[model samples]
Target: MASESLIKTSKYTKYTSYKKISYRSFFVGLLLFIVVSLLFIVVFNAYSGSSPRTDFHEPVNLDSTLLEVVNLKSDARLSSARVSNCTYWDCFNVYRCGRGGHDKITIYIYPLKDYRTESGTPFSQFSKEFYVILDTIRHSKYYTSNPEEACLLVPSIDTLNQHSFSKKHVSQALHSLKYWNDGENHLIFNMLPGSAPNYNSVIDLNTGKAIIAGAGFDTWSFRYGFDISIPVYSHTAEKIDSSQPDQKNYLIISTQLNIPKHYLEVLQNIASSSNDLLLLDKCKMDSDRIDYSKRCEYTTGRMFSYPDVLKEGMFCLVIRSARLTQAVLMDVLASQCIPIVIADSVVMPFNSHVDWNRISLFVPEDNVKNIVKIVHSVSKERRGELYWQLRWVYDKYFASIEKMTLTALEIINEKVFPLAARMYEDWNMPEHIYGPVNPLFLPVTAPKAPGFTAVILTYDRVDSLFTLVKKLVRTSQWHEARGATPAVHPMFTTFIMCDANRS
Candidate 1:
């Protein structure tokens, strides 16, 4: 009986010991859970504090009645009370009249073109007229000074130049204007020559600093300056409808031709031989040599819409003009027509957007005979490829005018305007006085010069030589501009060692 009681006691002791371990484990787990929860709470609070909060409140909208303020005198005081009382919604509130008391930067515009008038004027007149119109637009929007604010400074009709001002006059004006250096005023309008002499004078005065806007002006003069190349926007896509009559093969020749007589004669011969080419000369044709074959002639007097012309043709001839830039080439792309470029030039102005080989056939100007060969070689299958490629180009590059305009505006606002303002502020002031300045010119370190000369082997594409030379020149110039000696990198130089006679 004693032995049995001792065994029962041993079993009870083991059970009690197990119960104690279980209770201790439970308490340890509970403690860990509590610590983790506290850590998570702290992290969550820290994350919430670091995040930014957006303002979601609606702004008050301004009234159209405020537009009338444009006609008021420049010295007229805009009431701070009225502006402060005005409600704005989803708009930039002009706080000039408020407590800020900032000096407003004023931009003046003078538009010469009457937007209401349908009759087109000369390019010079158009520029001047547009300046006035731009000023009016800005003024109507109530651009004015409060204290230190950016505002539009449009002078009344009396303030505009009586006639188109000369370049000298413009330069003198630029030099004399203290307001331009004040960081609170600027001239943002276009200018036109009052007379031919004024235009010449400006050309002479501005020299390397001026840029021509359109084709009528010289582009080379602005090589060292800034130019605003306005692209012509078209809303047309070339559609190939099988239902339409295919009998009319429209040959559209839109080029500014001022080449040698021989060049014109060669083109005339080719057009005369082919009934498919339609020559649309924007200049007076050489009547004595023009081949009056079935080819239709459109003279220079009328304003020809690009879409209408492109729609009538399957193939468009893009001939190089001494005066015309890539403006027309862009138009052709917009119309989705196949451009057959006949130029002895490389480095197309619109290279960023165009794929030369895919959408267009680049023919060297020397190989005039190839024109017929290229035309005949383009089978229906090839045309299909060309069409789809052109469509892709349009979709990728010229798809959104509004987006492009907005992007341009953003650039002007964020980059150009700020830079101009700083320039004005720092005008006539030494760099040391203006705090630290960023390096405007940096040196370019070219790789080591190639031991052997690089040669490009070509059969008949002489026109491509110009492009290659231009690229080389640009690279060299870039290096020189940075005050660096460019050594041709032997490792990077490509050798076009080819046996062209084989294929």
Candidate 2:
């Protein structure tokens, strides 16, 4: 009987110890949970004041007006605020753009000549550039098939390569479109837009009210608000991917054929004397080629190709010849070679949005003799900065056919609908400054960027200083509590403390 009693006692003791351990573990976990919760709250409160937030109001079961600001009534605004569903570009999602902004700035692409559609390589395409332009818009947020609902219209005719597309053929086709209406509300994309032998800046077509988004717009030809100056895109912009050389072979490279005798002489003199310039002319005959094709060659038995050769030079010369706008400008930029543009009164592509002076060196035609000294005068640091900036610009705006087409569309979208326009920083600034943005929402009223700075000057009063910081923290909490995303500016705090002990 004593043995049985001892066994029961031992079991009872084991059960009690297990219960104690359970209680201890529960309490430890509870403590950790509380600590973590408090840390998250503190971090949230600290960061509440300086976060970037854009305000938007989405009404459920929205109507069919373009996304509208809460209270904008200007003619510059798209459609009517009261009746439009989607009015802004940034605030569009599948639901908003597909259903709402569909009616806002709706772009309709005219059907191409029979058998030439956007899908699966139409048996014939004007050029890859033409196909790219059509395909991009078709996939964009602004496309529509109902001409009745379209705000902008694009032509189906091929206007990309002037050498291939006859001006007469394009004009006749454009005139016959079912919705041409004398080219009213139409936007045409033309890279090289005139007849050759003397490719005039004029499009040489009866475009009527159509806006020319062409590359060859000199100051004399570009109608300020009516036209858009677009980039002369390289045929092989995407294929070339070269890392910048640690050391370049030439300070400047000029591959312009058919330049004036004086200009050619000047370049040759610079090349021979300083050995810093490379003047390349088209190969009169290539023993390597059984067929004749373009290959730039220097007289000293050195042959070169555009862009590839451009990578070997620090700067590429873009001088005015028969044409003000040249393919070499975009070519050099893509190769990360700085452009030395000498054309006077030439308005560059997307000039309303881009700062060309930031990436290029522009000199007057009269300054041709001092070109060497001018390029030499630039510091190494400046050259590095310019090349890096050029890379950024080229990638964002001119890298591929898709980018060029989309950039033009975005510009036109902004122009017609001023309220839905992209910000200056969106187009010109580096990504790190603002980061990649979808432009999901915009302010309801006049959008104002919010900045906050808290200045606390404490003179020998540690307690008051602490109190001030606590109060500032509470202000951010107030915003958070009000259902607003609180973003304290990154540069939000400045402390000025004078300690009595220091004396």
Q: What is the C-alpha lDDT of each candidate?
A: 0.41, 0.69
Top candidate by lDDT: 2
Summarize candidate 1's per-residue lDDT along 403-429 as a digit string, tens digits.
Answer: 332222222232223432333213222
**TM-scores across all candidates?**
0.38, 0.62
Kindly list the per-residue Cα lDDT of model 2 for residues 1-503, writing each as its tens digit.
99999999999999999999999999999999999999998899667732322112121111223322122112211211111122223222222122326224667776555322123222223576777788888877777766555677787667666666534444555665777766667777777766757777756666766777888878777876667788887765566685777788988888766677778887777777777778887776637543222445454857676557888888888987676788778778888889999888888988888878778899898888899999999999778767778888998889887888788877876776677777876777687643665568764554222336555677977666655655676663334355643344233477999878764
Scored by TM-score, the top model is 2
Task: Assess candidate 2 and give its lDDT.
Answer: 0.69
How badly does each model clash, as a count of residue pairs? 32, 15
Q: What is the lDDT, from 0 to 100, of the residue 70 in candidate 1?
A: 20
